[model samples]
Target: MFGRGFTLSLSVFFTLFIVFLYGPTVSILVLSFQGPNGGLTFPMRGFSTFWFESLFDGVGVIDIWGAFGRSIRLGLVVMVLTVILSLMAGLAFRKRFLISSFLFYATISSLIVPSIVISLGVALEFRIIDDAIKVFGDNMGIQWVVDDFRTTMGLFSSGLGAQLTWTLPFGLLIMFAVFNRFDPSYEEAARDLGAGPWQTFREAVLPIIAPSLIGVALFGFTLSYDELARSSQAIGGLNTLPLELRGLTTTVTDPTIYALGTLTTAVSFLAISIFLILFALLRRRTNKPSSSKRSTL
Candidate 1:
């Protein structure tokens, strides 16, 4: 809608904006590799991966690799669940359901709630249930497993739930944005071609909206991986990467935290790259003339 001059100015502005935003992240990444004797600021003494290796460093109760693995696993589960549920909810929202409006607003409310409050609720609810489980174990002789499950694997349970509370709204909102641009005639054509509901969705609708699904998955994974607030209490006995990083603040006075931040940022960047590659490939595949004619929804 603007002239070429305005367009060029906007482009330059965004370019500078991106650089401004990523400048600190780039600095952290560089500092992450600071040498053994190097301070956190600058003037590198040498270079080494000592900080990375010292993540656990037999330091304390923290298990760096274990927490990292838990975070990855939880992020994947949350991503998959978010994509599926958001797509289903989006489709359902288009129909005249009995409680569609109620459900939509409920989803919105979850987004509006403070992360800490939601986390507290999750923790309290789990505590109550665990207490009940303890009573049951006391009587029925199933004590060991119930006693320390939180320390061992509570993230997959309560932690995943807490992450979902935040992720699902994002997924649903992305689905809404995607469905906004969707043309229903594509689905109608698939149905006209004798495609069953599932078949139509699989062959037609999904391929068209695949990019947005990737977006939802991307959101879910990143948010869950990087989440600190809700995850603080909801993660139960064991900590995730963010919690580990926070715990390190008091004891760690080196580039180790920078290394951790760099590692996390790399993983996040890797995820983004993979999703972008997949999204591009899907777009290209669906954009092909012959394929588009038959498969584009």
Candidate 2:
């Protein structure tokens, strides 16, 4: 399918895409170093790390550290939970069940649905949950759901739900592809070699797919880290980095916002680098030729 015509057209398209992707990144990185007296957009007013220093020192109006910390914590939580749950769901999907078709469609549906719609549904569901809890508490004469309960739930419930709607579909699909391409003979061979199920997965399956698992985790973390629409109506009390960054857009007229974007992008790159290193190590460890395949020295 890759004819000369296709190659030429694809090359142009790919080049344009790369430019589109990296243009904002480069702009943000450069502008983030604007001098203390710089304007929002280019040309360079001056070159300084004043804005970046302002990041740690809170040069802007909003709580940069607090919002940043919240975003990191939420992303981490989502990453771990997404990896484990999606792996389980992916494996479960391998075996046919009574509602397998329904579950598959439901999982796929989450991705096709608009983020705003899912966010709205999560918000409404949490509201219903709060109301139901109140009614049940009143009937049982239990005052356990104090303001604390409401506060915690407000921060976590809808936010978590909304984010899961976004992350789970992606994780599930990745795992589905991983499993579909997996060779069952490997597992059977492991079993024949007297390895238990846990042993088989640990020493056989896991090492092979560890990189993809890392990829899903990265996707989960980054998705939740930058998520705005889901956390827009879902998160209460505390705003994430993206939301606070949005707040900066209205209140501040400097490149500090670009600094924030740069910081986040740097964090994403760092995470990606770390995952790649781990993946490389795993690949090296698992890529050794088998004893039978090894050549005599």
Candidate 3:
């Protein structure tokens, strides 16, 4: 049994933790709406939408908006690939073999290594590969890596291989958890009912795992979308939202950056809310009809 003093202490800790986490976000949102030229001062003056307006007008519709679009696209690609690779690696891991050992080690390595270190190593590797290709001039044995449009989509050939190397491990761990809990009986039952392994997985396993899969995908998407170091190194100074925000801090000391931050935070929050609501609705729909309705039938 827990003591009263312990409970009080725990409650205080949680209250402080929550406040620490959310206080900056609340402050940023408030500052975003504060008048443009005044800067963030106490005893707030009148509210204005000038920052939001300036975001569209001053930055031009192309650069900021285009970078936003590219970031979203990169995030989507990373999520899809991460999920696919994770699912494959996870399922493979259920088997006990040397292959599983290699994957296990790979996943752990990704988690252990620092992101900046990984980025630097990858960039160097790519540079070496580029040099080889240039020397051979069409007879190269193999190209190491290159930063190009494909990298924009989080592709390895485009020099995001190292970034994926980092993200895929976390993703694989998530999928491993999902697959670990999956009972073999489900597969057996499906096979007994004339379903092949692939068919069984498609109908029996995937549907059940859909929600967890989506949650993992969401995490991967957000992780890659907000990633700064990998994007900065892998793409060779190309700007994602985070990179842009950091660059903007140097010259554009306006409320617009705060506004952009607020916007990003709001969009992420709204998205998570919508996903939760939709998940609940879908779950309710999948439940069997009430006993009263069944009896009436």
Candidate 4:
């Protein structure tokens, strides 16, 4: 809105901010790979693969890996659940009113609730359910499976649901952003061509919004994976990476904790890079044929 000088000033400001934030992160990453570790020397006491080797040498690396895997699975489930719930809520409230406002505030409140408060409520509720199981066991022949597969699933789903309190709001916003720009004419055309509602959605609407859906899924999954407070509170029996990392940092003061931190950051960076590459490829694939057809026309 101003001049090139304004843009240059903004760029410089952001550059300084990024450097300030990432400088320590870069230093730790470099230090994590250093072989000889006394404290935090700069020049490194001769290069060696000690740090990387130590990752699996003594520490419970297998447990860390298991936690990482569980986090990934939980993240995927949370993302899917968030997307599904958001899609339904968004579509249902395309025309907003009092109900829409109420739903919006209700969904957002879950995000605002303190993690400790939510955790207390969840724990108390489960305890009551356990008590009920005992009472039922004494009265009836059926003993409730509080620790069974079904119960575990319920806990997992509920934990993810607690995450969805905020996840759904963001997801819904994304869906609305996508649908706002969508051209209903395409759907109408599909119908005019004798396509059914589901067929129109599959063939026309989906293709138009697939990128947004994928973007939302990735964003929500990343958020869920990195979340610690909610995961700690809601996940009764499961341990996620963030929780594991915290426990290690607190209980075990090993230098390998730095290695774990470096690994986590590296994995996140790699995932982001892959997503960017895939997005660029998708855009190229979508554009090339259209450009070629336009040239021929």
Q: Which candidate wins on TM-score?
A: 2
TM-score of each: 0.87, 0.89, 0.85, 0.83
Model 4 clashing residue pairs (backbone): none
lDDT minimum window of 10 residues, candidate 2: 288-297
By summed lDDT, the worst window of 10 consecutive residues in model 4 runs over 146-155
Q: Over the stretch 1-297, how does candidate 3's per-residue lDDT look in tens digits?
A: 789999999999999999999998888899888775558544446688888888877563337776677677777788888888887777777789777787688679877878788777777777776666555644543344332222222333443575577678788888888887877886787788888878887766776666766776777777877777765676654466777777777767667887888887876776677667766664563354656523322
Report the lDDT tens digits of candidate 1 across residue range 172-278.
99988888899999889899988899988988888889878888989999999898998888887788888888888887777877887888888999999999998
Whole-model lDDT, candidate 2? 0.83
Runs of candidate 1 exceeding 4 Å displacement: 1-16, 56-61, 136-153, 291-297
Weakest ten-residue segment in model 3 by summed lDDT? 145-154
Note the Cα lDDT for every prediction shown: 0.85, 0.83, 0.71, 0.71
The numbered model that scores best in lDDT is 1
Predictions ranked by TM-score, top down? 2, 1, 3, 4
Rank by lDDT (best first): 1, 2, 4, 3
How far in Å is the alpha carbon of 228 misplaced in model 4?
Answer: 0.5
List ranges where model 3 is wrong by over 4 Å.
Answer: 60-62, 138-159, 281-297
Better of 1 and 4 by TM-score: 1
Task: At residue 130, give the lDDT of candidate 1.
Answer: 76
Cα lDDT tens digits for candidate 4, 105-190: 77677767887776667666666766777666666755444334233323376567666665777888888888888788988988
Worst 10 residues of 1 by lDDT: 144-153
